[model samples]
Target: MSLRRRIAAVAAGVLAAPLVSVALPSAPAFAHGYISSPPSRQAQCAAKTVSCGAIQWEPQSVEGPKGLRSCNGGVAHFAELNDNNKGWRVSNVGRTVTFNWVFTARHRTANYEYYVGGQRVANISGNNQQPPATVSHTVTLPSSGRQTVLAIWNIGDTANAFYSCVDVNAG
Candidate 1:
């Protein structure tokens, strides 16, 4: 009611705005998933096995516009995932390689696509509920050499897809 009291109340309300939001009961956080095994570039960073940029904080959220073929899910803040100079760790694989995807919040999956040197090596149907915490598929690459494996997880219900790049020296 008093002027000084009113001014204090206004200042308190302004200061408490952020805390109020922080204190509110919000919905559970559901994170998008990424490749963990044969660790994707972001995965490597997330594991702290490789030192790098922002992707290190959110390896499981490397999502971008739907149908994006590049790592970092075509997002710039995650651009480090697409950088070869990031000193990404590489794995050795035979012509046949098994890619393991780790999902935190599983969505109905449309399909899983695998690419090597821009060539589609495998197209597996995922027309079902999200797989387990880790879903793996063995794909046979056409050639053997050092290359990047681009894995795309297309959501069955939505238009977006998760992308991950695994660098490997193929034997």
Candidate 2:
């Protein structure tokens, strides 16, 4: 091949590389985060502490639109998490308890919100950085009772958020 032809081919290949990648299907987004500690409803399902359906396979993926309050996080299939069941193990927690989030794929978070009995308790502003494998937050519960704590992870750049409902007996 001529040097000019060779150089042209190389240049063409270099220019097309990015386009090819953009055209191809991207990697599977294992992109989900869920509360594992204090064992959220989904966490219980994953741990077999509670018998559940598809949620057992993807506890971290219980996500939905942002700014909405729902146990399933707007995921209708996961509505069972809202169902009252004595089988769901309750964690006895203190006034200040730490909840751990296990992320399969990290996204820039907007903020972390904790709610109890339909009231917002703690709000941790996100740093907008890709979070590590596990993110822990120590929240001070302003009230006490056998209440379910709903933890919401709001993504900074997206209109979606992940939800995890943890059953806890505030002691």
- Estimated TM-score for each candidate: 0.81, 0.83
lDDT of 1 by residue, 1-171 (tens): 999999999999999999999999998455778878788888889889989777777778877667677887878887777778878888988878888888888888889999887888899998767677788899888888889999999888887888999998889
- Clashing residue pairs, candidate 2? none
Local accuracy by lDDT, each model: 0.84, 0.89
Model 2 per-residue lDDT at 116: 86
Q: For residues 1-171, could you state the per-residue lDDT of candidate 2 as single tens digits?
A: 999999999999999999999999987567699998988999899988899988999898888998877779888888888887647899999888999999997899889999987899999988887788899999988778788888999998899999999988888
RMSD of 1: 6.0
Off by over 4 Å in 2: 1-28
